[model samples]
Target: MWDSLVLGTKPYKRYYEASLLTRYIPANSTVVTSNTDSEDLRSAVFKTADGEYTILLEAKAGTDKEVTFDFGGEPPVGKTFYKHVYQADVQLEGNAVIPSASGSFSTGAGSSFTDSDIDAEHNVIVYTTLPPQTQVEVTPLEPVVTAGQAQQLAASVIDNTGGVTWSVIGSGNGAVTAEGLYTAPAVDEEKLVAVKASSVQDPDSYGIALIRVQPAPAAGRADIPQFSLEYGKYAFTEALTITTATEGAEIRYTTDGSAPTLSSTLYTGPIFLTTGTKKITAAAFKGGLEPSANVFRLYKIGNVSAGPDGYDFLAYDGAEELSFTGTASIAYGADGLFFYKTLTGPVSTAGLFEDPNPASDDKRYYISTLIQDEEPAVTIYNAGFEMPVTSAYLTGPITNGWAFDYRSGVQKNGSAFAAAVAPQGTQTAFMISRSGITGELIQDINFREGEYELSFRMASRPSYGDILPFQVYFDDQLLGTYQPNPSGSFALVTTEGFTASAGYHTLRFSGIETPQESTVFIDDVRIRPKGSPPLPENPQPNPLPEEPELGPPLEELSNEGFEAPVLAAHRKGPFTESWYFNGYAGVHPNGSAFQPPPAPEGNQTAFLQSVSGGQGLIRQHLEFKEGTYNLTFQAAKRSTSGGRDHSFKVFVDDTQIGSFTTASTAFQPFVTESFTVSAGAHTIRFVGAAATQEATSFIDDVNLNRLDASE
Candidate 1:
């Protein structure tokens, strides 16, 4: 063996060996020995006498060829091949097949090969790119390539792989083929290839055909096949086998027009489509591959399961397209109602429900129900009062009346008229008792319905004893008139129908003395078919359906702090009577307007409810810069004798929040009052009283509102 056998090679790879095979052996001797095949140079294996075990020969080639590999953990888009390639070299003690010589070559076949001779041998990696113009003819080459060959994809054995290596063997974001094989690297529309055949010593180097991988033309798929479904396929047995230019690919069938995802099983066979002209569509694809769509129309009978006896799971859009398409199935065990539904129209009528044989558990049928709702009750509004019921008989004396005589009907118990239920006290008044100090008598009566009759010998002694003609009033309205017999005997003013209807009503009596003698006196009073008169005006009115409103004004609570802030004081009380908020309210507990200091954070402005209510001129003054204020008291009645009514005069310095209205004698609940104060605590009071007639009145619910000054 001689070093001259090999030449022009440096930067050799390091190695360890059992014994030197090239130990100066004779050039003529057969210096070859069976080696582990992976050993890089298999130095000239020749042993000398005495077994020194040394031989010399050709120098080894450069380091092994560097194969750049790449791949994506995705399926192959193009018809890339994979084949398992095991290293073919003489195995060294450590199995390290350091290449004897290697250098990249950009010229001459795009490969680095050793000079070839009878005994020349070499290997090296070089890239060969399939240009954009290279035509690809995907021939199922190797007629017998797939026969029980530990079958691996052609992409595996990319020995001396020249094109893109997305990754080296067994590495990086890459995917193995279904056949358990990996391809070279993934290149963008670039084609790298592996060779099935190459010369032995041609560096054992391989070359790939330069054909651009055009993302493997997406296999054109046959439309979702419309089946001539026959009895052989009683249960829709056809695979709906969508034939595509691709094999081993999957079809995502959407028989219900629903989107098919990875979770949807592959369309291996026909699916029993649901009722209504079935529309079956399929999207075919390989992993990370573009999708091809196929749509097919077919009729599937609702055979396996009994659908609505009259319809084929009714069609919603229209009854014209009711049929079972093979994508969905009306299988025997399926549960649920399949009819088209709508809110407004009759999807299923009452009669359509097959009696569900409620008597037995096994019996099943279709049934539906109807829902009806009641409308809201109507609210009523009437300015006039209301009397719910009517009935009664006569009962009572004819006292409480005024004879309209200055001598007897004076504001002090002077009687000229009579009344049934008028204000009986205070400055305001009602029925008078007597007239002229003589005997001017009056009669009180009730109406059959909302009306009343009055029969009295009324006489007016206007001046000392001067009698003047007078009239009677029914509930403040003047009725008929009558004259007086000085003796005041029975002067009938009503024989019958005189009292219109039955209800609580007022009757006034009056007449002229006609220069009369003794005071007039009347008698024989009667009232019947009575009805409790409606109280004055009813408050709440019926509101329009769409125009509801909560009109009460709201006030800020507990407002405090300083600088300046807006403040609205609120006051609540019986809407019926007027209130007097005398400054006395300010001094006493019932009218307390307490002010508190500001909170620390109040850098902003602060204000108070400078407003108030009082008698004649009273109110919650804006105690900006405080000072003492005076006050008075007044709970006096303002009604006529035998009657009662009250009104309050509230003034805020001069503004009034206290309004006044007379409280009628008709049945009514006592009311409450309230008000809002500024950003501080405050005390408030309620004055109570009544006239010389009935009992006194009282005010309650004296509340005050305050707010935080800052916010």
Candidate 2:
């Protein structure tokens, strides 16, 4: 029996042919049945002469009484077959035999018989070659990818041809090229993508890699705008166009000095601005993207106003009305007030009388000012501190019609009314002592239901490296606070727009003295009518909303860096549980006693430097339900007086946990520690360890994160 197996290769192909023409017959006998064991042929491994290539082959029944060998699917090239084929029941011209023999063939070498014989019955076997066993190894077993991003992939075969074909398993998942570069789809939905790499040498063998698709890129907030014209005044008309670089972005704009929102007017064409000054602000918006930064432009189309030097004003004194006519002038009575007048033309004035009533018909006064002044008014009794103090220092609360209240000390300080320092015509002025104490100086004044301006002269002597601060209150309502600058002469301090009803009201100068030794002097405390003094600018709107009423201090703690820098170390100020620094015994870090350390996370860090050897303490109040939380903070230490290690103990409420210490001046790595706070309000504090010498300890960036109860 004769059977033929063909394995052909193209001219330029790198593989050789895998064809064999086999002539198997009984030794020296006529051709008959050619039966072979199918199992043996199927399990045979075919290889080349040099064993460089291997393939698996299967044996099957061929037509016309012959056995055929099948290479799994297609005949693999670049190899020869040398495996033995089992023969059974061989018949040559009516003779049968039960023996088996081996046969061989090569694609380039041709078929060959193992032995030659004649006139004998014997089994004939054929050589078998196996198809190459190929496996593909893909790089990056699993990878995370974002939508619309491309990733390069690689595949290699183990002990076989390295060639591989790449493809994606499903539709709309993404696209992959033959070279293994995959490009994800534009959709943001996350999905798992299966990429396959099939071996070219073995069709049935492949490798799969899972690509984890992540969400789309984030659309961040927009950028601020750029203006074509510089911000300044111009005489001629100018055309302005609002533009943003973001593609397909729409610009919403406002020309009325209001913030621009999505519902504002959409900008399409250039804005033709003429005449008056206008403020143009614009913001960009796009679908699926965050709005761009806002751009602001102020265009002054006409002449811009200047400071006080811009105009001339005629000056007149009290009870003196000799004025050659002009539109604007300054009238000096008990005070100096700006007055504007409009007339047919410039002319000499008749005797002008000043009106102090809100509903007055004074022709010389501006109608607005005259109408505002029409309300009844009164002057404070002994407006200036001209009364003599009963003694060198105030021994009691009441003296010279003024009452004093101190935290713990007597009302004692130098008098501004003394002959040496008092201004030329002054006789007596009150000096309030500020020596580590809290106090208030007050007086009662009867007002007739009118708005008034309180003006005074204040001076202070430098003390404790800080200016002493004082607050003014009217009828228990805080009006303003004052910090008198240490000048050689007195500076004027004034507060306006103080309205009073028809009754007696208490005015006060209250203060909590600093650790420094300072004194506040008061003279010429005058209260006058505020008859429409050009109507002070509108009060600024509060940037922060009013905090909700929190029961039992449930509000979260804020301002980790002591908002009051003076609270650092042992220096005194108002210390609250939210933030306070004090020391006892011996633990103190050495640095500035009052100032914070250099380069803090925020404006300042609570720097506890050992001035006198004692334990330094810093505390914060926190309220929480029963829960576990992570406490994190950054700490730093330095040597100021001695090289004593700056160590501090951490505590939740009053119970101490572990301690932290660093000897270098640089800040330590941010550390996190866990602590459980039982239900209710608690305090987290850091106390410096007691040391004999000075060392500096710093703390900043304190945060607490709640954890799950099960964790």
Candidate 3:
């Protein structure tokens, strides 16, 4: 030890040495080792400048544990060269002693807050370190489970310090096992298990909980029912059943084939069924619960039935049916329906219509109902035999948009019914027949393959320049002239296209006479390649001649317009609402809602915005200006049958002024009238006036022009 400063030093009574320091040996390894009994070195200390004591020593520190030495007292404040040494006691009662520092447990990892794996057999200390004032929580929230099962659940506890014990709060198992993890009961059941843990080292380290339960997985459902039906046919239906079942099952169905809603009734009876396919489904539902999926399946019911035999095919069978009438209604029947008539003053020839010829081998014809001008109509269908038989075939006469005057048929191009005007009346029509060919250009069409005969009705007749002269073009080759010489039952005839391919081809029965029989009335025409059935008649029906058509529900007519809910019998109809709609034509339902393209000739509609004053006043709802307005409307006069002359007139006020008649021949403008409106709102109406001459007139496309207004 060395003392550098003795600030204003004053001598003490005991002469306390200024500083004393010395170093020499070891204890266990002899650091600062000194022999206390060594007499020869008793005076070996060299003198200091003022006799202050200072000694040098060696150090010996050994062992893996930390080594430390404590100074007995404070060192001199300003000492330059002083040293001290220590070691494990070499002679502490003859053994060394280890030293220790103030090492302790803490918030650091392994030293204190450590986490261990938790399992069925082992749960070591779980340490969650936190500041003294902080708190924490751990929870066991979501857990997974297997399919088709359920159980009770549990959660773990939590605390602040570290190692903790989790305890169950409710009724579930306390410990979570390796393979037997705790699960909560079903949601329908009451109690469940809850768990948590508390720390001991830091008192409030963390707290946590967990929960587990069975899952309510979605189930697989069976298929639902599917089908539709006609009223008179099947009395049975079907439904599908579900499996892996839950309770409170229900099933719903519809006869009209509409989809079932929740409010639909449940099926309870054993439904009857035929042999055709249909849809069926079953569902499961209870109060306040979501309905389970429907079990669906297709169930076949029955096949279509055939038509009856020997039924009458008359237009006015005295029954209220549209298509098949008299005796048994032919909704699905298919044969022999005829009506008897007699001789007439005038006849319809060179016009398209169906006629009964008992002169043929059979007396049956095929027919189907359709709608024309919104009125029920018919079409005779001859599925085969466009190939003419020399002696007999299956078609009637064809005309150029003009009616047959008697029983007119539905004219068509392909499957669609033909429109009235083919631009202009410039095309030809023929009366191709399968009866006897008494004249030339006619055919007997009832024989087997490889044979045909053609003839006409009357043999020879008076003729002018090029009268009744037309060539027969066979496979694009002119074969012979069409002339008749009325004769034998084993008729002689002419034909074309016998060497041509056998398929559907137009026979082109055309001739241009000098206004004398120019519209060829020649019949007996045919051609065939092979054998087939004796042939079925056309499906189009023969319209009644000037006859009344009584419809379903038996509607009657008198003179009063407001007396009944009749459509066409009234003085006026379709009112002012002439928009684009085909299903709304005339006063009848076109059977379907409006569709685009052909369904709506949106371009064709009428607006009766103008009329005469006294006959009809403008409805208060309509507004128009007063002026000398020029108005025009398009009119179509369909096939009509009643009396000799009938007028389809547009009435100005109450007086008839404008109209369309059979006289125009096709879709042509009829009459035009002018009316003066008294400045305010005025009304104009389109009316089909009833006349002494009976006829059916159909109005299709229409246009209205106002000299003063744009609309």
Candidate 1 has its poorest 10 consecutive residues by lDDT at: 380-389
Q: Write the per-residue lDDT of candidate 1 for residues 1-711, one digit (tens) a residue.
A: 111111111111222121111112333454436332334443333423332222222323545332322222343212211211112243422112222212221223221222222122352211111111111111222111111122233322222322222211223223434333433333323222322322232323322221112122323432222233311112211213344555556666554456555544355543433312344545566665555444333443222222221112222211222232111211111121122221322223333333322232322221111111211011001000011000111112211222222332222122233221111111111122333323222323322333333322233322233334455565556665555444322233442234443333455444444434323223223232223222222112111112112232223212222112211111111110122222112111110111111122322111111111111212232222122222222122212122345444333332333544345422222222333334432222233222222222222222232223333
Residue 235 C-alpha lDDT in model 2: 41
What would the C-alpha RMSD of candidate 3 be, to one decimal place? 42.3
lDDT (tens digit, per residue) of candidate 3 on 43-64? 1122234323222322222222
C-alpha lDDT of all candidate models, in order: 0.27, 0.49, 0.28
Q: Compute each candidate's TM-score over C-alphas.
A: 0.16, 0.22, 0.22
Q: Best candidate, lDDT-wise?
A: 2
- Sorted on lDDT, highest at the top, how do the candidates line up? 2, 3, 1
lDDT of 2 by residue, 67-165 (tens): 343333333443464533333232221011112223344554333222221112232234434432355767775666778899898887753665888
Report backbone clashes per prediction: 149, 34, 121
Q: 2 or 3: which has the higher lDDT?
A: 2
Clashes of 2: 34
